[model samples]
Target: MKFHPYNLSRERLLDFYKNLLWPRLIEEKMLLLLRQGKISKWFSGIGQEAISVGATMALQQDEWIMPLHRNLGVFTCRNMPLNKLFKQWQGDLDGYTKGRERSFHFGSKEHHICGMISHLGPQLSVADGVALAYKLRKEQKVSLAFTGEGGTSEGEFHEALNVAAVWDLPVIFLVENNGYGLSTPVSEQYRCQQLSDRGKGYGMEAVTIDGNNVLEVYHIIKGIREYCIREQKPYLVECMTFRMRGHEEASGTRYVPKELMEEWAKKDPITNYEEWLVKEGILGNEEITTTRNELKQKIEKELAPNSARLGETYAPVAEEPTSAQSSLDEVYCKEATSTSETAHHGTPSLKVEGTSVRFIDAISSGLRQSLRKHPNLILMGQDIAEYGGVFKITEGFVTEFGKERVRNTPICESAIIGTALGLSLEGFKSMVEMQFADFVTMGFNQIVNNLAKIYYRWGQNADVVIRMPTGAGVGAGPFHSQSNEAWFVHTSGLKVVYPSTPYDAKGLLNAAFNDPNPILYFEHKALYRSITGPVPEEYYTVEIGKANQVQTGVDISIITYGSGVHWAIAYAAEHLDISLDILDLRTLLPIDYEAIRYSVKKTGKVLVLHEDSLTGGIGGEVVAWIAEHCFEWLDAPVMRCASLDTPIPFNTELEQTFLAKARLNDYVQKLIDY
Candidate 1:
């Protein structure tokens, strides 16, 4: 609780000095490797070691740290092995990422570190999410997030700070103002004189410090960490430093003036800290030399074995099955004998007497039940708290569950999903509602690059569900009306769920919350109030990755999902002459291949329909699969129908002409006649 630096013991001071030495030596070694063509890239934090090491040392070991690309000191301070770091740099199979990622892109759940991606700004929101989890659990731990001055220019930076301030999350947003964002200087990046000043506008405690002084940075962050934990509020610390070297080894300093570089080099963090240690009598000059020599020896020993094989091609190491994957059978209820007994959270058995509920109400009821059952389940979206979301799916949720559980967020798609990743990492299940599915593109990087790959890359389960309100209807225009389930289906690690009926909406959401992976739950906006069906009041789960036979016929199979299912069923009901088989695909990714094969084989004809655009839609994937697997059974070439490859029009007539449903009857008749 004491904030004075003089109270620190000599042994602890020496340890901080050692933390500085290791990353400095490792960065030099990595640069050497880059020159030798052993490594592809190197982002050095040579002059910026004090900020990373001092801030990391100030936190409790249980607290989380989300480091940017330049924070090699944070990794070393966390005691990540030098051998693993070297192997990762060389892209070896034995590395932390198992050769899947390149330099400095790795995280360890055991170490309480969130690995960073190339996009630098999103991690701030993720760290805030982790801090939010701690606050929710009433833990005293804090989360530290690092980014450079250049990253502060991004929109996510503002969104993250605002959310953390509004929620009073226990997070430390550390901005290492290293003078340059790649080659662009601070003058061009922002008009503000001080980067930390921006944090004050968000109602957070903000400070600026000299990063070259390790003791100053260490003392300030130590106080900041305690302040965050004690007050349960966020703080922003901007440490002004310089990048002595280029962004990477290949990025030259030709753009920077020699005089400025020389001026900053004089205040090198490692040298300044080492001299301070020696002057303070904590370490002698001889001891400093000996420590540096020992670190050099350790680096040489770690890199020796991988030196020769650095550029050699090697197969990527296979990830061992994690608890999430091993427990998939139980989560998905694949082998469960009783659905009611095996439901998540041990909820009561569902009664067969069903009540007719609208699609949106079913989704809300399922979410409410999950929230009541699971203490760790959190619901977040823009205008979701008081306004009950734009669609009123979460109406009265804030009043029922309180704002802490049912939270409102800024209009930031990236932060909503990115922060959910942090919550998932901290053992909380977060359900994020996108105002509309069309806006998902704003968070595409977090979805495709981060959330989708987190589990596959490190065997860490991102147990988060993103609720996507989709499809073109109600004249919401192009921005609001889009059936983008196919975009997520194209991504590998994500599970795509597009349920039509109310029963399927409630059941699938229950299943999605329990599944230990990222799920994109696509609910058709058109069907939110329009569709109603029998839904059990008791909690239950519909198996993901399975198709339901809505109506059985022998002539042809009509494959569809979401709003498309209604069109297919209507066509079948009107024309009783053609015995149509309607197969509604509840889940898109991990498609129901067995069901498709069986239906196509029995009918010997197929018509795949969806509301997505014609090119690169789920229809193409379905048609391709049928051609490959059910080709022999096909009596005719597979027919396909989808919306035109253009933006949804506001005009009702133009919208009808552009939609796939307008031509579904014609396509089904052709498939049957063929």
Candidate 2:
């Protein structure tokens, strides 16, 4: 593990010394770029160039890649068209497709290269999922994910490794130990002597090699990749490299020793290997000089076109063109009809054709029907494969549909979201389930930033159905039980639906699948087992944004959804003399504004309700819409009954007290009396 040296023919070594290779020149130029103010930062793989090149060369052309910031040296050398590369380095629009990504965070669609993201450890999960996809399709390809020792600390890293190891996925995880994380030394960051030892925790085979040796890197990476493909196994390869550059371009002086700079400079891997090549007769003086000079020239030529126009390139923009697509205007549109699972079915409802289905089974059944109707549908998430998902909603999916459609994902929320986006772009109906909707927060980048805005900006329908198991009654507490419906309910371009009954779960799920925009299906974990209604064996669809008027009255409108809807109905049935109109707002954002208007017109009063907090709750929006557009139709001021602005309590008494204090649906009859 200390070092790897090879005895080879001088002629072979000389030929391998193609200094003009894109990577050699890129590292040198990037450092120059930092000095010239072209790029504001540089995280060099200076003494670590060999591992970068070795791992990259070992990958197949079709297999996608996700590399960290420092691996620009390998990425540049991989023939990622220099024009876009320079723009990215210079912070121009063209550098990254959507000027939204960081300069070092770039991807090449032409090369099947995935864009780099900020959460370093999460990319490993993405690569694992990508490799899993290849395996499912029988493609015999592998995806490589690269990160530094520092990133190995992230929980996502462990989750990704565990999934890959347990599934026998075709993925290669590479760790570049540069001995430092920002300013902290590796000794202080990790307890283990070698970072590779961490892989053992996941039951993965680990290989550690000196990163400075180019031939050694090539040898190890080549063999590992071959073994992975031949046996369909995942491997962790740690390259022990050193950094010649500081943590970043701006931190040249924040180090421990005055001699540290000189010490690492003398050990520069590129220089050391070139020298060894010449001394061993593997490379002649002319060949080495020519290769180095040519590499320098090619890089210069590639970067020259953008040196003057740096930061002037076009930015990557999202896909919204019409307000109809941007907002929840597609609640029911002509296009939705064409894409409907049953082209002729209209406004299907909960009919007891005699099937008792669990809430979770309803989700899976709805999905299965949609996928069967539309072959473009694809489902992915952690343990969704043989394990059938943590909740078993995906149980028996792999064997029934096979792996191509049903998949187990690496625990990278962002990567899972990103790959789902890509698959959506390729004309697949991507259905992503957050293992626990609580952890969906980890991929806020993909959800809020990417998935939400794709259709609004691109004018294309990104039909991604994200199912989240939300609510707080299961004793999972805090992290796993936070109610997140309000977060997306307030966001535009999203449809939020909560189905309390299995029958409604199926109908709404089908409607969600038919929607042209992204939908957030929040399933209350408490309802998954207990709340079973009659579900028909045949497929059905509900009209999104259409409220279900459970009761007809003229005194007050008790508007609610999800868990709150049931309480609203129960309260109305118990107090028929109060004359209450129980209205269930099927879709949160598009909202059945017409139904609410009808209720307000009939009763001249309204009582909005929900399980979420009153502060910025969906009820507020409905009340505001009534005030603004249907003010003449109102009789009294709109009233809202919602959860208290406090965390869901673990104690049963406190929870009941919390619900009582908020009065949510319990206040429905009271509001009617008022």
- TM-score per candidate, chains pooled: 0.92, 0.79
Q: Write the per-residue lDDT of candidate 1 for residues 213-313, one digit (tens) a residue.
A: 88788899998988999999999999999998888878888999999999998888778777777776778978978998998998888767665565554
Q: What is the TM-score of candidate 1?
A: 0.92
lDDT of 1 at 268: 85
Global Cα RMSD, each model: 4.4, 5.6
Report lDDT (CA) for all predictions: 0.84, 0.70
Report residue 417 deviation for candidate 2 (angstroms).
7.6
Mark the 10 consecutive residues where model 1 has the least summed lDDT.
Answer: 341-350
Candidate 2 lDDT over 197-273, as tens digits, reads 87788887898987877677777787888888888889998987777767676776467465876776676666777
Q: Report how far off residue 333 is in candidate 2 (Å).
A: 17
In terms of lDDT, the best-performing candidate is 1
**Model 1 C-alpha lDDT versus the unseen true structure:** 0.84
